[model samples]
Target: MLHHRPAHTPVRPTPRRARTALVLAVAAAVAGLAACQAASSPPATTSVTPAKAPADRPDRGARDGEAAGHVPDGATVFDDALPALAHLDPALLAALQAAASDAERDGVTFFVNSAWRSAAYQDQLLREAVAQYGSAAEAARWVASADTSSHVTGDAVDLQQTGGSQWVADHGAAYGLCLVYANEPWHVELRPDAVDEGCPEPYADPSQDPRLQE
Candidate 1:
């Protein structure tokens, strides 16, 4: 006898299950699109602050000199901006200015190399001279003590040698300006008597000056 076989039947999904499957597929596609957009996007930027610049400081040598009443190079007697020229004794300044004006007619210019100085600056110069000369006596020949220095008192001025000293040497007596030191030809002081009489003989050096001796 032959045996009989049962036929296979196809199974269909329920409506609820079909709906859940469709929703899962749509959710997966949305998640993939979001990931792709994130990957293509630019990176976030961070803000940074710039560093500050350093403060400016003046040259030590120049600052020190300026503070000590040292005038700039090529300074003239008419430079009222500089204390070295402006602080000079009134009588001395007037004589120098008058002589300088007349000197211009002769093609000579008066340049003041050194003039009024702070007492501290004078003391510093004396100390430096002593160190350079190796003795107080040798230094005294060039630099005087602050107490006795005419520069500190604003009664003396040192002129540039180029045209100033020679012109002053020739015409200074007429204006009451006279050289006070034989060694320092550029140094001048006002002596009213020099206008009528003449400049007295200069001391050989500061060392021989009677005023410095005191």
Candidate 2:
């Protein structure tokens, strides 16, 4: 009975087995911590502000039912009229500025009411004119039609002469600009060749050009 059980050394756990068990437990604990961290973490992101538009972007359109100026670059408000300043061709613009400067020197009076416009802006104006006049045909007679719009080219300017349209008509050509349509003396273009090209001048009729279909 009280004979010490077979004089046994304390039954030792095998060192290798103990080490294996320790390694397994440590791995399991590490895995559990990783899961907890993942669960508590928030999405790895931050607030984003809208990017500003570029300086070269179109920046001109209509204002208060009247032609306006060139638009500044970086504008994205397509639905609304772009600010004046967007539609100037640099070569013609410089020439125009020089001419205007000379006129200023000479005390010649001219007022700029409009400049370059995006195609969409021109389209909008046509629509509004149609709405106001109550028919597409009537609107065409009253305002610039969409397809032949010189405004879309950024080479056109709607001007108000200080003296009269005739004054502007007389002086505008010295700057390589001419009235595109005889009807709208205010609508001017930079290209004189358009007259020689027999390009079906928008002055008499502004129906859509069949060539534009190509």
Candidate 3:
């Protein structure tokens, strides 16, 4: 004879334990989603150079040794025959290059004997001239004060008088160059109007230029 048995059922977890398990499952799902999103995201871009502060920013309009028409550094002697012209005013240099080309066409080679000089160099020259001449007045005739020197400003160039200055003196006016001082035939400056109107009478010397009187 067989005996009847009641159906056996598994016991469910207690309410507290069931709630805890659901909470853990939800938390694990959320964490997994966050990790997947992170893995799919793009990497951040890192710059090699740090951004400069406003005070450390570079001047956009300035170039090496030339800020607002400041004189450039002298070029090395090994560079070119007219290397000194590298330190001269742009307008003056352009005029000189044109004049030199024209002179060369006529079988003359122009040369720059002197161009820009630093303030320190100009001051040293002034001191040497004063010592050699034994008077500031006599020195002033040859070397202008650094404060007023065209060389310091890169506005003047001295050419070899024998050929370069002689050639330029004859033809430079056509290119806007003019001998600037009556006593210094080798010294020239840009006078744009001279291209068509001719150069004005030169000052007697550096001492006579009003810029040097002070």
Candidate 4:
């Protein structure tokens, strides 16, 4: 005799199980979307502060003269664009031009290293000199006070180039350009009497100059 077999019934999830499954599916989809968003987003940035400059370092940009009268390398005495040259005393400028023209004949060009500084610039230089030399007296030998500095008065120039400076040293008297300090061979000043009486002996240094006393 064949036994009758009961048909298998498909098991249906209970209400609680179905609700739990639906909540799990929704949570998984939200997690996937959050991961995708995180992957596509740019990395977070951090803010950084710049380091402060040293207190002892000279501030070259703070001085008005540096902006208006600073002489770049290869600058000629006739560079009208630079206030260093343009602001020079009329007679001194004329003398320099004359000497520069004569120097060109000998294949030497007058390159100005410094000229016509503002009084504030001169004071800054004096402070720097003091710091470098470790004393006010030593600094005075190199840099004069703003009130006494020929640079501040637009009456002095610092020339560069070995050939050009030497040429000026040799023939400067004819043009009334005189080296005022024995220590500074590159520095020159207009001494109108030098054209007639020849250059007076240079002071041993600016310290010994009577003009500096005043």
Candidate 5:
């Protein structure tokens, strides 16, 4: 008798489960897009760079001289205090040795009286000269202009030949040394070949602080 009842199977939507799954999938997709958008945004980065400082010079004389109105650069500070033959370039030293030997052979003994002077010492000399002379004008007569002065630059040397000034004047050519200034009898400079092309020529007058070239 109960079998006469129509067969009833529960009808539900598998499509409802699909609809719920689709909504969850779309939500996940939106979340994934938000994550990607966050990741793609540019981040700020800080970059640090260091600054460079001016070069330092160890030569006290050079530093003080510059402050006190002298013109020698820091690059030349180390060079200003080297001993003769000791400070000279090796090849130049060899040439000097050969020339000295030649001078000896010719019965002239070439001696180094002085070479290499610090700018401070040079300043001291100038000051002392001024004190003694009583004015810059008078001091200028006794002392040399700092720029053209060989004593200030290591390149200039004081030489005393065994024979005499005349002997050196006659024979110094072989050594490639010359007397550049009439006032300095004991002074001799390297020949043109040995001389640095960078060496400043008769420098500017001290009364006017014109730019000097190397």
Candidate 6:
């Protein structure tokens, strides 16, 4: 599913090219087993009390029926360009919020589909993936160890919403956000240099990211 684009692959807007890219990206997201809610896993242990969010965050509470497992509904919120995620990296969250605000002017909204998962949740997810896929080796391609996951450190976010991913794919570099994987278009991370120097080339998947090698 991850079409291996030669390094420095250029993005173009032709309809045929768009369709090809869409097909490949969708396949990659599915095969790579990324995307938060789209790739469901077992429930996490629930916590009655959530850590306090920043004062500047929107004052919203848990909504019924979000797909982020047993985590607090308070973990997710809908704000200008923010997604419903818990424990997002403060800097990344702020940058995303600002980018969302700008995107709204263009009629695009970004929503957080996943963020900051506990190690227990991630382990459970890996276990589930292994069971569903029938092997740890296969599952490893889809899930990472708890400690290595950016989601655990609140440094990564998976998005949802109609055009959010596409918009970010096109304009996010200006805000220091860059798509981290060629297969998982929904996954993004802060790339400070992207704000001025442009986004760097993407890795094909988690396996290729140096941070996950351990």
TM-score of each candidate structure, all chains considered together: 0.73, 0.50, 0.61, 0.72, 0.45, 0.61
Q: Where is model 6 more than 4 Å wrong at Cα?
A: 1-86
Ranking by lDDT: 1, 4, 3, 6, 2, 5
> How many residue pairs of model 1 clash at the backbone?
0
Write candidate 1's Cα lDDT for 64-157 as tens digits.
7876888798888888568887788989999999999999998888898899999999999999999999999999999999999999999999
TM-score of 6: 0.61
C-alpha displacement of 51 in model 5, angstroms?
A: 55
Model 2 global lDDT (CA atoms, 0 to 1): 0.59
Per-residue lDDT of model 3, residues 17-118, tens digit only: 889999999999999999999999998888798876799677665442233223334322122334355677888887887777777788766655668777
Tens digits of per-residue lDDT for model 6 on 23-111?
99999888676666545867687879878878887534442222332343222224422223536777888888888888889998776
Q: Name the top lDDT candidate.
A: 1
C-alpha lDDT of residue 100 in model 4: 92
lDDT of each: 0.90, 0.59, 0.77, 0.88, 0.55, 0.74
Candidate 6: give the clashing pairs: 83-112
By TM-score: ranked, best first: 1, 4, 6, 3, 2, 5
Q: Write out the backbone clash pairs for model 4.
A: none
How many clashes (backbone N, Cα, C below 3 Å) per candidate? 0, 10, 0, 0, 0, 1
TM-score of 5: 0.45
- Residue 43 displacement in candidate 5 (angstroms): 93
lDDT of 5 by residue, 1-214 (tens): 3558788899786798899999999999999999999899998789988875657637787566544334332222123243433454444345445656666676765555555455666667778989997997767654555565555665555555445344446665565555645555655566645234322232233332232212
Scanning candidate 4 in windows of ten residues, the lowest lDDT window is 60-69
User: For model 2, how does the per-residue alpha-carbon lDDT over 55-135 read when each residue is reduced to its tens digit?
Assistant: 876544334323443443333212123444434666656656655666766666445666666666677788998999899
| Displacement of the residue 92 alpha carbon in candidate 6, Å | 0.0
Over the full model, what C-alpha lDDT does candidate 5 score relative to the true structure? Answer: 0.55
